[model samples]
Each structure stands twice: as C-alpha cells, then as structure tokens.
Target: MNDGGFSALVVLDDLAAPRFSPGAAELLALMDSVADACPLDSAALHAQASAELGLGDFGPRDYEERLEVLLAAYRDAPRLSRAGRVNLHAQFLQLLKNRLLFTDLLRREPGIAGIELAPPVVIAGLPRTGTTHLLQLLAATGRFRTLPYWEGLEPFPLPGEAGVVPEPRRERTQAAVALMNDAMPHFARMHEMADADHVHEEIALLASDFSTMYFETLTEVPAWQEYYAGHDQAPHYRYLRLHLQALQHLRPGPAGAGRWLLKSPQHLEQLPVLAETFPGATVVITHRDPVHVVTSMATMVAYTDRMFSDPTDPAGTGRRWAARIERMLDALQRDRSALPPDRAVDLPFADLMADQLGAVERILAMAGERFDAAARSGAEAYLAGHAAGHLGRVDYRPELVGLDPDDLRRRFASYERRFLPSEEPLPVDN
Candidate 1:
C-alpha cells in the first residue's frame, strides 16, 4: 500500500539514509559511524542550554517526564540517519532551551503572570480544512492578536531589545528559517514558514512541553504515542495560558486588541481541555470529508516523518493516523454535543472556500465582535492579496495509503451528518 518511493527509501535507509534526506554520500558514511553514539544527554543538554542562555530557572521540572520518552524513541527509531538523529537531538535541546528562557523571563518579571488574556477565539478541526486560512483571515481583521512566527519559534525576548542595538533573536530566527528553506525547500511549498508569518498554531509552544503530537507526526514513535494516548493535557493548557501572557507582555499590541486568535487541528482532539482552560472562549470548528482529511494528513505526516526518520512505513503510518483521526472525530462529536450552544460555531470547508468573507462575518458575530463594512472589506482584502491553497494541487489517494474511503466515511458518518456540508447549521445568515 505504500507509494512509489516508500520501498526505495526503505531499501536504501540502513546503508544510504543520506540518499533520501541528507543528499550527501559522505554524510551517510558519517551517519553509519555515529549511529551507535549516545543520544541526547538530557542533563548535559539542559545544562549547556542554560549556560548558553545565561538562565538557570526551568520553572518546574515537569517537562523532565517527557525527556525519557523522547530518549526511548530516539533509541528505537529504525535506520535513523546521522542527519535525522542530529536534527531530532537538536530539537529536544532547543525545546529545553526555550523552556529555560521563557521560565527565566517569567520568573524575573512576576507581573507577566498577572497579564489578563482576552478570551481566545480558537479554530479547530480536520487538517486541510481551512483552519490556517481562517486563522490568518481572522488575524488580518486587526481585531485580534497572535504571535509572529519568530515569536512562536522563540517566545522570549533577547536580553536587551529595549536598547538601541539590534535584537539578535530576530537575526537568529531569520538565519534558521533560511537554512531550513534551503535544506528543505519542498517542505516550505507544503507548509511555508517565514520570519514574520502569523502564528499557524501553538504547536511550537506545545512542543516546549512535549505534550502535543509534534514528535509523533515527525517520526514513527508508537511508544510515545501510546504513552500520550493516556496522558492528560490540563497542565499543558495551564502552561499555554502563561506562555500567551508572556508573549503579550513582551510584545504588547493595540490597547483593545479583540482577542487572541488561535488555530490547530489538535484542538479538536482536546476540546474539553481547551474549554476548561479558557472558559467562555469562542471556538470555531471546521468540517471536511473524512476521506480527504485522513488521506491528506497521512501524506503530510509521511513527508515530515521521512525528513526526520528513515525506512518510513507508509502503510503502517497511514493506518495509525487513520485510526487516530477516527478517535478524534468520535471525541469531537461527544465534545460538541456537550458544549454550550453559544460557546462554539461550526464552519464547513465548502463554505469557507466558497465565500471566505461570509464565513469571517459569521465568525466575527460569533465572537461578539462587530463585522462592519470595514471589517468585511479587510477580510476581503486579505483573501484578495493571498491565494488560497498555495500548496497547489494535492492528490493523495486514500487507497494509496491503505485507507478505504468507505471505512473512513463509516467511522465519521455521525460527525459528517452533523457538521459536514449539507448538514452544517450556521446561526448567521450572512
């Protein structure tokens, strides 16, 4: 069931992993030589990052719990090329570094803990269902505040940006982006990132705590997934509140910025947690056909997995994700039924693409914000300036990934009937 390149990658992985991702023959040999080296000395990594950042506090060592899980995955991931191992190791260190930096800043400035947050307007639903597009439009309304991509990547300010000198953090973020774009240009085509792009999701912030699907999607880490399957995200949600407040305090936007606009497909899986953390926050849920959603997600995850892994199993990967998505849909249905009517609104993928401005107007009304002519025009201008689905045509066949369209539809039948096209009921008549 795997696609064209799957077997070739697997066959070459153990001996020539660099052939797939690294692209350099010598690096492949080096990877073989270093494959047996120790991975991610957590204490040493933490100490080094702390010294580098000149910060000692790591808030609570609660995140330490995830370190062992990551180490386990690093050890078990098969045919992990030197490049893949190196990248994964670097990411963990960076996450640790971010935790130290953010915690130190928050600890030094106690007032950051008290900054009140506008009840967020969160976008949730299936991947490829216009959540990012909707979030960007909502942010363009200028009525809401969101983090810049760089801020999302590096949430804390450098030591002295209030001075006249240039901030080194910006330069660092830019350089990193450039390197990534150069190294993996195709990834940008699918999920482009830049120095100042709007916050796509809180994934990076969640990664700092290692509580999201950040690692699972990037690699075939079934053990971590199994562990996370039973874990509670309440602590992560609490940390998210603190994290948002820190971003707001460091980069204060307009006096009356409407609210914090957030989006992530992960939200659908944990809607109750979000509701509990930010009570009274407005939620927007997007719906698309399950067949398309499942297949597209598998392909995207496979791309990322291959980048950070080797000998990727397309069939197994797709099967695991398909099952996960089915569970998410089931959870979504239960949560939506339990939610208060005024708390959330459903937006169908068809409606958003067919008339984005109309969808935005409906969203604005749901958020209790005015959608005046200017606001309508702003949303229109946002769409006019930016092409939708800039990833071009994606043709991921469900069968190609071992997923049956009928099975996906059957699994999501109840959800589709309630929220998908022809059944979606928007309160607004716009």
Candidate 2:
C-alpha cells in the first residue's frame, strides 16, 4: 500500500492518462469483446481490467476515466487478426468470468469452510535450477494434488463430471502445445509438456491483480517491471492460498490427500513471507551453479520472447534475470536464518538428477512423509518416460547472452560456497 518502499508502484493519477500503443490497443480490444460477452460485475471487472492494464492507484475518479479510454480504444479499433485476436479475447473473457464467479461464490457462501488444504510443499529456487522438472516429478508421485494448468486457469463453478474426462482438456492442451511447438520448437526439447503435466507459478492468477514479476518477462517494459519489483509479492501468495482453498472445495480429491504442491521460482524472493503465511508448509530449496542457471534461464526467456515478439535480445534477458536472481538469493539468505531448520530442505540439482528416486525419498523424509511403493514407482516411471534429453535441450552460452560468466560466478560466490557441494565449482557452466 505504501508506494515509498516499492520501486514498482505507480500513482493511479499518472496511470489515468491513456497510453495505448497500436499493438497494445489491438490486444485491449480483444480483451474488451471477451469481457462484454462474459458480463462480469462492474467493480470486479474494473479492478481486473486495471490490473491487466498495469494501472496502479489512480483512485475512484481515475479508474473510471482510464476504463473509459480503454473501452473507447477497443470500440474504435478495426478488427485485427481474427484467429489470434479471437483466441486472446476468449482467454481474457474466460479468465474474468472465472474470477468474478469465484469471488461471488466466496462472498455468498462466507460460511463455506473449503476443503482443508494442508501438508503444503513449495518448490522454490532460482530460475532454471530444474525447479520445473522437480515439480512435474513430484506431481507424478500421486501423493500430492497439483493445480493443473487448465484448473488453475479456470477455478470456478466447479468443473463438472463431463469436464473430468481428460480427452477434452488434453485436446485443448495439445492444440496449445502444437502452437507453441510451431512457434518455438526449441522450448519443447528443453521442457516436455503434456496436457496432464503439472505447470509452475500460477502467475496468471496473480496477474489478475497486476502485482507480479511475470509482467516483466512478458513485455520489455522496464517502467512496469520496476514498479512491481519493489512491491510486496505477499499478496499474490495470499491470493494463491485463497484460490487453493476454493479449488479444494470445488473439487475434493482422494480421501486424506495432503495440501497442494505449489512450485514457482518467484517464491524464492518471498521466502520469508511465504513461511509466515504457511508456517507448517514444507519448503524445498533447489540449487545449481549460478553461471549455468543464468545461461539456461536466458535461453528460456529468449525462446519465450520469440513467441510474443520479434527480435529477442538474449543479453537483455540475461541482465533482467540476473537482477531477479540476485534478489531471490538475498531473500533466501535472510529467510533461511529466520525459519526453523526443520521447515526447510536444501537440494542440489545434480544430486536430484543423478538419483531421482533417492533424491525424492530424502525430500519426503525431510518433510516427515513416506512414499508408498506405487508412488515411488510412479515417480521412477515418470523420470524414465520424460528422459534427460528433455531436461536441458537448449544449449546456451553465458557469454553469448551478454553475461560475463566469471562476473556471474563471482556475484553468486557466497551462495555457491554455502549451498553447493564442495567438489562442484562455484559457477560451473556445465
């Protein structure tokens, strides 16, 4: 709420001025059409739209003015690429519809003690430290319920039994997968995705509030990123918990199943806050050489940028990523000291890969849980099925991405010394 501390907060008054580029206008128009069809609550709709547009506290008067400008732009714009525009519009509409419905349900049923969410496990680490793979692997164990991409995106009105059939969801997911493959085939090689596979960082849910690091990665908008960088990410975590509660209530899982397994690289930067929110939660910290992490992360960012824009700048990606990782390391260090020793577990990427089963067994042990043979075998089968080739398919050079390998290594020297195995180099590229 206090703008002084956050580098990313924008006074709502300033954001009231309409500043839509041609491309942004086109996108906004799509969103408008979708929202119109869905017909969400006006106040909630405005809040959602404001967040999407990255408009901070312009107060009530400014909110109306800004919304008018945005609506006018959509009304005046000519139809764009039908396929792309329609898809974007539909996605936003669906998102708004779900959020509004969920919010209404929560309000109406204030007494609803949603299905209890417990035994929480949070997978957190620097980007490209194998956090994604680890999450998918853990999800496959069947001991935990992970928020699938589809469910996470649409967490309202309770998905019906007809929707439970995996076919429709799988088909939709496959289509999106095909599009991504067509657009950026290189990414699939690095990260294998299936319709049922677990995804990381439900940022879209957080994006509903415009307070997320995801905005930075989506656009080359430094001003917006700077505003978010300084703000507290704790609210997003709170939103996550509420949604998880809603999801559990809507879709009860197997009897006595533990709480949701949530994974996100962003969680690393808000470790202390996350611990405070979920005190009993099990936290798994993944570690890897900083240099390799940067390189791998830059490549992934480069690939993602290509999907939405032209001319992905690898160096710019690396620099932004480096800054974020730096913040995360700082947070982790501070939180590690504050948290009880038993609540946290540190793991090496290399060790996890070398013996996936053993690594997971130890992790579960640390969390005070035991894995049944079926869960263990399921995890093993998942690893064998996914394979290592899927793990870092995109070979990237730190130097090519404008990263000085030595400098990066030096920057994370303290982290390496404290967490990395003695035999491993502080910033080993490979």
Q: Please provide TM-scores, in order, for all candidate models, with all chains considered together.
A: 0.86, 0.75
- What value of lDDT does candidate 2 attain over all alpha carbons? 0.61
The collision pairs in model 2 are: 8-226, 8-227, 8-228, 12-57, 12-58
- Runs of candidate 1 with Cα error greater than 4 angstroms are 1-38, 160-167, 421-430
Give me the candidate number with maximum lDDT: 1
Reference-based lDDT, each prediction: 0.71, 0.61
Candidate 1, residues 1-430: lDDT per residue as tens digits?
1113311211111211223344343444565567445366777778778877788788788788787887777668774556677767677777888898888787789998788988888998777676767877888777788877777777776565543245556667777776665544344434546455545588788889888876777767778888887899889988988898888887776655747888888889888898988888889998877777787777666655644566656667678888888888888888875546897888787778778877888888888888877677777787786674343333455665667888877888887777764843321111
lDDT of 2 by residue, 1-430 (tens): 1123212222211111223345555554665456444432335555664565343333223224323333233333332223333443444445555555556667766654454668588888877777878888877777776777666655553334335556455456566665555544345544555454446456666654445566455425555555556667776677667777766776665553566778877778777778877778888889998778877776566555543333346667778788778777977877776556787888888777778788788777766767888778879898787766533333466665678988898898888888984654333121
Best by TM-score: 1
lDDT (0-100) at residue 316 of candidate 2?
Answer: 76
Q: Give the TM-score of candidate 2.
A: 0.75
Q: How many clashes in candidate 2?
A: 5
